[model samples]
Target: MSMRVPGGGFDSTNPIRLDFPQSLAVYDDYAAAQKAVDFLSDNVFPVEQLVIVGTDLKRIERITGRLTTGRVALGGVLSGAWLGLLIGLVLSLFTTAEQSSLAIIVGTLLFGAVFGMIFALVGYAMTRGQRDFSSVTSVVATKYEVLVEHKVAAQARELLAGLPGGLPDPFA
Candidate 1:
């Protein structure tokens, strides 16, 4: 089944299906593919008929640093303090002048810091050094492909040919 948009065109129910798509161009990066589409839009091409697909995906992990109890505790303290500060501020808004807003804020902050440190230490201890390092992971694509509906492929090609260095060598 196909879903209809306001303009009466069938909105693609499935993103993966290309609907008899033809490759307009392929680039090593997503930005280049986006730029090509933007150029098409500027030239009054039907941008809705285009799709950018990322292919050859790879997961990359970068080791940031070694994990330690002290670091964990510090992180916990900072995060907890921020949360406490936000809570305290909200509470302060509802409090009267006689309620001493400053005390409440400080009290919550101190409590949060202690709580955060304890939680962090407990979590670290539970891990038992099984995971000792911290790292950031990202999934990236090696290539981006510009796809157009088959009917408009020739027009897209003709327009892209006017762009300098926009079209890659088909034979290559």
Candidate 2:
């Protein structure tokens, strides 16, 4: 999303684009790109005129472990325990002194664990052997490019040049 500034150029609500952006440099990783901006800030350059863009996106799924009935049941029990504890605390707060809050909490905790285990086992059984593993998925960029507004591109480049080993690499 972009909006027209007072000048002929435009500004973006996205906070990442510039008016006629010029590539200040390309980096192999996000940290490097961040470092470039940090360097500019240290030098008192107009840091707000810059943005870092990730390119060449790819999806990655890292397998954590194989799932089993025991692990699933244990996970469910732990989750339910937390929920039951919360409920029991609130219910105990309204009870008379004759009613032992400890007993009420323990009762609810046991019931929750039993129910959670049963539900987790039944759900796992329905899944069958189709999806038996656990994994984490994420989308990441292979490259990061730093951009600067056209009006300040030259100043940004000059400041970046002063950074140790930060000159824009033509071949990069």
Candidate 3:
């Protein structure tokens, strides 16, 4: 049977080394990790053979929510962009320009839109697809975990063992 292990971050001293088996998937966030497990179950991945390691109650709930949402990052970048453009337009009015040209107004709008898009893209890229902002909640921290496909946990452990940081804490 495949095993699931919560991969933990090693402290500064005495770095933990794990031999993670093959067919393993690592998730930085607990919710995303669990979501994958849930999806696999609904899509013919056996639940009985599944193992969830190293997660807390809060992380489990968050991952369960991701499973329900189907991996859509909740926040609306478009809406944010629109609001930013409106604010930019309003602020443009306060600027002291000798003549208000059509080009100037259009340019301001374009600038606002472009900047908004850039900001959105940068933020999105930095997040690496974990920004579920629609619910007004923030990701507190990153959770590392190794999940193996059903019946491959042993192989996964063997593979993980060779990885730089693949050990699970005996205490945790």
- Candidate number achieving the greatest TM-score relative to the actual structure: 1
Would you list the C-alpha lDDT of every candidate in the order shown?
Answer: 0.84, 0.84, 0.49
> Candidate 1: where is the Cα deviation over 4 Å?
1-18, 170-172
- Given candidate 1, what's the lDDT at residue 39? 89
Q: At residue 110, give the lDDT of candidate 2.
A: 80
Instruction: For model 1, give the 10-residue run with minimal summed lDDT.
Output: 3-12
- Model 2, 95: alpha-carbon shift in Å? 2.0
lDDT string, candidate 3, 1-172, tens digits: 3333443322234233223423355556666556655555555533334444553324222333331122232233354556656766776677677655555566656665666556656666676656544343333444545445445566444544544444444345
Task: Write down the TM-score for model 3.
Answer: 0.27
- Tens digit per residue, CA lDDT, model 2, 1-172: 5676553344666655566889899999998899999999999877777888999999999999999989989988987787788888888898998999998888888888888888888888999878788899999999999988898889888889988886658695
Give the lDDT of residue 33 in candidate 1: 90
Q: For model 1, what is the alpha-carbon lDDT of residue 18?
A: 49
| Model 3: lDDT to the true structure | 0.49
TM-score of each: 0.86, 0.84, 0.27
Which regions of candidate 2 fall more than 4 Å away from where they truly are? 1-13, 168-170
**TM-score-sorted candidate list, best first:** 1, 2, 3
